[model samples]
Every structure is written in C-alpha cells, then in structure tokens.
Target: MTANANRLEVAGHSVLLTFGPGLETVAEEIDALWYHLRAADDDGATPQIRLDYALPSGDLPAGAVPLPARPEASYTISGHLTREVIRRLIGTRLLLHAGAVAHPELGILVLVGASGAGKSTASSMLGRGGAYLTDELTIITPGTFALTPYPKPVSKHDPELGAKRDLALGGLGLRPAHEAAAPAPAMVLLLERIRDEDEPEEGSSVTRVPLSEALTRIVPQTSSLWALPGGLATLAELLNSVGGALEVRYREAAELEELLRRLPPAEHAETAEIEPRPGDVVTWEDTAPAPGRIAAVPFRQALAMESGLFLLGEHGAIHLPGLAGLVWDLLADAGPLTFDQLEQLVVEEIGEHPESTALVRGTVSDLVAHGWARRG
Candidate 1:
C-alpha cells in the first residue's frame, strides 16, 4: 500500500498524476482508475477523474503540482481525481468521450457512446489482438486524432470474461495507449447494448443516420464539456466536421471485433460545391440548406449568415445582389474584420446610401447570428 506517482501523456500534453497508497494493487482486475489530481489554480482542491495514460504528456510540465492526499479506504467500484487538467491539456482541441482502437491491417475505429455502452469492454476485447488507442476519451484536431489513454486500473467483473482474456487485478504503472500516431477515425461508431431479443447474431452491425441525432446522443457522453470555456461552440464545430452518423450493435466482443475487421474503412466525404447563382428562393425558411452552406457565424456574441453574394442578416443585405458582392469582397480583403470595421468598409467602398447602409448592417447582423464570422 505504498504511495506511487505516475505520468500519462494525453492529447499532446503531459499530466503529472499520483495514485493513493496501494491503489495499484487492484489495477488490472477492473476497468477504471482511481486517484486525486491537484487543482490547476493550486487552490489545494482535488477533483477526481477516470483518465487514460496513453495521451500525450509533453504539454504538461513537470512539478506543476503534487498529487493530493488520498482519503481513507472505502468500498467503491471506481473513483478519480482531475482538475482543469483535461481542458488545459488539450486547449481547444476536439475532445470526445470515445474509445479509440487500431489494428495493424484493419485501420482504426472510434467507439462513441455514453458510459456503460460497452466502450471499455469493446476496447479491451480489441486490444487483445490490435493496438488500443484509448479506453475513455480521445482528442481530435484538423487532420489528426490523438489518443489520450488514461491508464488508471481495471476492476473485477465477469470471471469468465476476465479469465478468458487473462486480465488480472494489480497496479501496473500508467502506460501509453498507442505506440504510433493515431489516424483520424474513418468510422465513428455509436455503441448501443442489444437487448436479449434484439441482440445481433455473431457479428457487429452498423447503420447510418442523420448527423443531428448522432450529435444529440454523442455530445452528452463527452466527459467534461461544460467545464471548458466556449466548449459548446467548439463542440458544434466538431459535429459539423464529422458530417454524418453511425450506430453499431453487437452481442459478443469477438463478434464485434471480427465485424469491424471485415468492414471497409470509413472515409470523410468532401464538401459539396454550392452553385453560384440564386434562382427561385433565398432564405433559411425556403428550404434548409446543407451544412457549411450558410453556417451561423459568431461575431462576439451575436450570430449571422454568409450566403454566397449576400451576407444576409435578420433584416436583409444592404445592396442585395449588387451590394452583397461588395460585402463579400470587403470581408475577404479585411480578413476577419470586426462589425464596426465592416460597416466603415461598406461606407468607404459603396459610399453613404442610407438604405444601403441599413441593408449592409442587416446582412452583417445576420451573418454574425449564423456563426459564419466573428467580431474580432
């Protein structure tokens, strides 16, 4: 029961962590980790966490803070200690509460779902033959998905499964999840447990669904979004980037692994090209445009829409087709100019037409509302 210190690198950040005395004694038997993390503010508070060890630790500096003292032993399935560690480690990087696994020949699959959806079981099952990216959370950025493996400890469970897999309970210090860089998830799987009657026979089955529904189910599973500043906007961007949804259901771990191995790798489709000319209709209400077509640009705290030639606002574009072209040109030229600057630019470029000024202001307002551009 000696106290021990360990470090795990997740999402390109190094996290200095420590476990309570003798905590490692029970590590291998279960599927979770227990420890107390020092507060980021150095406020002498401890926040718990169930984290991965494989995440990058380079971002965490050494001796940042000492691990907090452990509480008196009590019977519990799992416990954790965290601070602003996860958010600070990744910054604005795309974070997901999903398990990431990779195979030498089979590629990578991201298992996304709420806790108790079999992510740990599935990851452990797959890691028997392939590489385990992470059993909990993963961070993704443009063109890369980094696995921040939190190596806490595993708990006791089904004897048959544990024995069959040779899983034992004992503290082995933290270990990285993957040896090589993790590729972006070709397929994002939302895992769901099958009811007795609904269980699929011998293989994993995948089905596609709308992106909205997928985001709805997947967002809540993310370990700590609310804790991160401006996390909601970041999450929305991530959902938009993934583009679609998928559901995976299976009965047995082996069956699911086999199914994943047999399936083709998932690919992100290129954004569809938008036609230049406007014809019959021209508003959000007319017909829903595809994502990226008219994204709500966030300016400061307001929202607006950038629709082709016109920067439509809640009111209307200043010059409609003619003036809209000028607005776009201004935005392109100025490069993320603020609303005040944009208004001034409009006056400079098109001169002082009251109706035109009103129109431009309206369009800018709308674009901000939709999150196409920001004030700063």
Candidate 2:
C-alpha cells in the first residue's frame, strides 16, 4: 500500500492499521498504543495489515463483523491471520504485542510483557524525548523487527500523564483510518511490575535478568503461542534467534526508560566464547539443507555436544566457539570434506595431544550425532 493511503505517521513511518466495526470503539486508543514507536527508522515502510472478523457486527462500523464469543478467540484469529500475512509479505517469523523505541544512534529498546503490565504507559514516557516505534505488537523476522503502528490516536488512562504529553484523543485525531504495520521487533524487554525496589541496579539504572528468565515471561505474552503450527519448538527457535532477553522491574515509566538506556545491545550468544553449562541455552546460526533434506528443525532446540562435539538436534553441525576454529582449519583445504575429513583436520590442527584431541573429537562427534553433518 502507498503512504498516501495511511493517515498516521511517526518519524516518517506510517502507523496505519484497520479494525472492523468490532474494534471501532477502541479505535481511538490505537495511536496511544503506538506512541512509543515514533522514532523507529530502521526501514522506511510501515507494516500493512487487514483485519478479518469471524463475528457479525451489531452497532459497529460499516465493514464491522461479529467476532466469536470464545475467550481469546479474537486474539487468536488476529494473530494467526496476521502471522501468515507477515510471513508471506515480509518474512517475519514472530509477532508480539509489545512496545519499542529507539535511542539516538544506538539500537532500539523493546518492552514486552503481559497485558496490563504497563507496556503502553512505559512506552509513552520513553517517547517524550525519543521516537516511538510501537506500543502494542512487534513483528520479528530474521535481521529486522517491524512495529505495528496503531491506526488510532494516543489514549491515556492516566489523565495526568496524558495531559502532560498534550495527548487528548480528539486533539490528535486519534481515530482508526487505515491498517498499517511497522517493521519487526528487534529486542524484547519483559517487564515485571515489582512492589519493592530492593534490588540495586547493576551500574546501569535498570535491573536486567538473564535471557532464559526473560523468555519465560515473554513466551506467555506472545499474541498466540499454542496456535503456532510447531508449538513449543517454534517458540524455542524464536527465543534462540532473539539472542538476549531480560526482565525489567520498575514502577515509573521514566525510570524504566532511564534504565533501558543504560543497557547494551543484544549480541548473538552463539558467537561468544562463553562455555556452555548445563541449562545454558545458546543460539547457533544454521540453515536448512536442500528442499528434500530432512524437514527443517524448529529454531529453539537446545544445543547439545555429544562427547564434546556440537550439533543442533538431529541435523546440522554447530560451528560454535571452539568448534568453529577446528572447522576453519578443515575448510582450509577447500575441498568437500566429509565428517571424517573434518575430524582428521581437527587431529592435524591440535596434533596428537590427548587433551586437545579429546576436546576436538568430542566436539566433532557431537556435530555428527546431531545430524549436523551427513556421511560423505
């Protein structure tokens, strides 16, 4: 769709979105939902979306349809349909209801949490000086995160905060005009509202939790988890690709923003040299083989090293830290090396030293056992 077709624009990107009459009542609040994503400029285009309803509209808009009465039925339908559309149009793999904003020259800060977890409030506070990417759902694909701009105007539950930002529904023309989606989400910050502020910040004002812990909260907050085709496997892969996850605890929105600014960028933990411990989940970059090659594995499978070799599930070698060095040496020959050829290269690189050989052998064994390498 062309930019002219949309009415809302933030940071030169469109936040246009459409909802059938079923959602007309809440249409005015959509912009407040996306107030935090005004500064996102990773890409110039906004996400395109079309809402299809399964129910009939009673007093809704002209094209309104009624939604099923089942609990979560609307969310399920919206998420599933949107996911398919995003995948086909933009290659996005995950779509989440979250908040996102960018730091001047640095990367964007994403806020993800359960419904009513203060994502919308926090996003607005952060957008005061920065740009807003989104206040609701964020779509994640490989390498990019597109924010779904709320078609409606900003709505503030806290009248005080709303007044502070000059955000009045009628004043900002906060009405649903068209449905437009932003880029996919880049980072995900799982927010946890804490009653006590006992934990001291780690240098930076924000208290950051481990990636795994963050995922526990993030997974549940997703638009629709059980509906995904592969279930947990698909969820796991998404968490793995996201690389870093954190649980943010803060009461005030401004405090949260300050804390987020102190955090660093998310890096691919798979590339790091940190030794993997039990319960340590890491992301490893691997591509599917040919079309006929065994059906593709979901992304979240844990990393396993059999006898010290690394591999992903029942297929593909894991070229991580220590193993990567060995793989580099093997590829030095520039030939189509079989598993055994690669193993031999490890032996040559580390020599006959028992400890080194054992480590290298274990790593290679793990790779083959996991279906990372096919017998040549």
What candidate 2 gets wrong by more than 4 Å, as runs, is: 1-91, 145-187, 196-205, 224-243, 264-268, 271-376
Candidate 1 error regions (>4 Å): 1-84, 146-180, 197-204, 223-243, 261-376
lDDT tens digits, residue span 272-348, model 1: 22222334222334433343332223111111113223232233222123555466556644555555666787888
lDDT of 2: 0.45
Every model's TM-score: 0.48, 0.43
TM-score for predicted model 1 compared with the true structure: 0.48
Using lDDT as the measure, the top candidate is: 1
